[model samples]
Target: MDDASSQSRPSADQPNPFSAVPIEITISVGKARPLIRDLLKLGKDAVLPLDKRVDDAVELYVGERLIARGELEELEGDQQGQLAVRLTEVADLQDGLG
Candidate 1:
């Protein structure tokens, strides 16, 4: 076989770099406190309270583990809001969820 034909042969042990990585993402959860009756009665100026406090850091859970905490903030230019997490420790890429 020629050099080109030899090189063209596929290797069995080669790893595919295009393989997708597994990543687990968790959003901050908050409870909305409003009765069904109250929810129906809500009109223009109705104010419903949440279970979490304003100063409290929002909890983020990846699968079953509590990964990190962060403060919610609204983006200036964009309409969508964002969360900035203060990472306590670097998550183990191999052991932990990607």
Candidate 2:
């Protein structure tokens, strides 16, 4: 067999194998689990507190996997008053499912 035969071609259905792939990334500030009764009782002004403090680093998740930890920041210039995450710690790819 030749080297050309060993390599596979891209299928017509997917022009680029990595193209059009979707990933969901979420930056979690904190988490809270309230009782059903408490949840129902919450009104407009009610505050649901999170487990994390204001200074704590937020977790960055790809779907349900924890990919990195970052600090929240305010974007300026072109981003103008928008919020963004500044990655402080990144998870190692070699780490087993961590």
lDDT of 2 by residue, 47-90 (tens): 99999999999998887778899999999999988999999889
What's the lDDT for residue 49 in model 2?
93
TM-score of 1: 0.45
| The 10-residue segment with the lowest total lDDT in model 1 | 89-98
Root-mean-square deviation of every model? 8.4, 4.7
TM-score, cand. 2? 0.74
**Per-residue lDDT for 1-98 in model 1, tens only?**
46997575656786444546776668565779687998999999878888888767666777766666666666555655654555444445457533
For candidate 2, the per-residue lDDT at 70 reads 91
Please provide TM-scores, in order, for all candidate models, with all chains considered together. 0.45, 0.74
Off by over 4 Å in 1: 1-24, 43-46, 63-65, 73-82, 88-98
Candidate 2 lDDT trough over 10 residues, lowest sum: 5-14
Best by TM-score: 2
